[model samples]
Target: MRIAVTSASGKLGASIIKHLIKKIGNQNIVGIARTPEKANHLGVEIRQGDYNNRHDFDKALQGIDAVLLVSGMDDPQKRIQQHRNVIAAAEQNGVKKIVYTSIVGNDSETAFSPVVKSNRQTEKDVQEYGMQWVIGRNGIYIEPDLEYIENYVKEGGIRNCAGDGKCAYTSREELGYAYAQMLLDEGNNGQIYNLVGEAISQAELAALINQVYHTNLTYEAVSVEVYEKERKEALGDFLGTIIAGIYEGINIGANDVHSDFAKAAGRAHKTPLEMVQEIKAQE
Candidate 1:
C-alpha cells in the first residue's frame, strides 16, 4: 500500500517512518513534513504538508492509499481545525484509509480536556465518513520525566498532587511501532487500539528509579498549588503549564488506563524501570 506519514520530522513521526521503511520499501512511502529538508534522510518521497495549510495537505496526500494523521501540537481549536482540513483533504484526494494518533481517555474531560474533546470530534468525523480507519490512543510518554528527574533526585523525591493516581506510560518508539503495524497490517480496519504500556504509580516509579540510580527516591505528595509553583519555577510558563496539567490529569485519574499494547506490538512493551536504567547508564 502507498502510505504517507504527516509531521514526519517529529519524534513520533520519525520513529514511525523508521519502522515503516523496514516493512515497506522507501519508494512506497511519503514523508510529509512542514519542512521537507529535515525529513530527506528518510529516503522517501517528501511532501510539504503543513497542518495549517489545506492546500499543502490536498497536494501532499494525493495518491496515498493510507495516511497516518498525527495529532496537532498546539491550541485546541486550531488543532482540531487542522485535523478537519486533513480529513477533508484525504476524502477529496480519494485516500482510502486514515490511522489517527489520538490520546488515551480522550472521551473524558481532563487536563487537556479541550484537546480531548476536539480529538473526539475528529474521531467522529473519521468514523462518520464510513471509510477504512484505525485509531491509536497513545499513552503518556515517559521521556518528559527526564527534565524533571534532576529536581526529583536533588530533592530525594518527586512532588505531585496525584495522590495514588497512576499513569500508563510508554515510549514513543513503542507507540510508533504499534502505528507501523496498524498501517502495514490489513485486518485491523475500523478498530481502536489503546497503545499503552503499564499503569505505574509515582511511588512505584520513584522506587524503580532509586533501584537503578542507587539513590534514595520517594514521592512527596504536595498540594496542587505547590506542585504548580514548583513546576513553574523549573519549566517556565509554557512547558510548566503543560506539565502542571499533566499532574492534574494524573490527579483526575486520566492517564490511569489499561490496554494490550504488547499484543499489538507482538512483544513486551518497554517498562518505565527499564527506561530509568537506560537513562542512568547514560549518565
Candidate 2:
C-alpha cells in the first residue's frame, strides 16, 4: 500500500516518514513538503509542494492508496481551506483512505472551544468525502517543552499561572509511530484515537529538570497580565500571544485533559517523568 504524508519537513512529519519506512519499506512511502530540498535526506519519493497548490497535489496523489494529512501550519484563517484542498484532491485521485492528524476533542465545540469550530468543520468535510477515514485527534507534544524547561532551569526561575493543572503531553516521535501503525493496519478506519500520554503540570516539569540538572529550579505564579508581558519581552509579540494563548487554553481546561494513546499503541506511552528522564540521559 502506497502512503503519502504531508508536511514532511516537520519533526512529526519526518518521524512519520521514518516509521513508515521501517514498517512498509521505503519504496511504498511518499513525503510531501513545501521545501523538498530540506527533506532530501529522508530517502523517500519526495513531492515538493504545498496544500494550496493543485498541480503539486495531483502529482503527489498519483498512484497513492492512502494519505496522512498533517494539519498545515500556516495562517489560522487558511487552515481549513488548505485541508479542503487536500481532501478534494484525495477524493478526485481516488485515494482509498485518509488518516488525519487533528486536534484533541475537536469534535466538541467546548473542547476546541476557542478553535474547535474550524477543526470541527474540517472533520465534517473529511467524513462527508467517500474515502474511508481514521481521525488521529492528537494532544500537544511534550518534546516542545524541552526548550521551555531549559529556559526555566538554566536561569533558576520558572514562571507561570497554572497551579497543578495536569496536562497530557505526547511525544511527537511516538505519536508519529502510532499514526504510521494505523495507516499500515487498515483496521483503524473510521476510528478516532485520542493520542496522549501522562499528565503533569509545569511545576512538576520544573522539578524534573532540576532533578536532572542537580540544581534548584524555582517556580513562580504570576497574574496572567504579568506573564503575558514578561513572555512578550522575552519572546516576540507573535510568539508571546501564542504562549499566552496556550496558558489561557490550559486555564480554560482546553489542554488539562487525558486520552488513551496506550490503547492505540497497545502499550503505555512514555510518561512525563520517563520522558524527562530520557532527556536527562541524553544530556
- Give me the overall lDDT of model 1: 0.81
lDDT of each: 0.81, 0.76
**Candidate 1 per-residue lDDT over residues 78-116, each given as its tens digit:** 887899888889988999999999887534544456667
- Which residue pairs show collisions in model 1? none
Clashing pairs in 2: none
Model 1 TM-score is 0.90
The TM-score measured for candidate 2 stands at 0.90
Instruction: State the lDDT at 81 in candidate 1.
Output: 84
**How close is each model in CA RMSD to the real structure?**
2.3, 2.5
Instruction: Count the clashes in each prediction.
Output: 0, 0
Off by over 4 Å in 1: 106-109, 232-239, 275-283
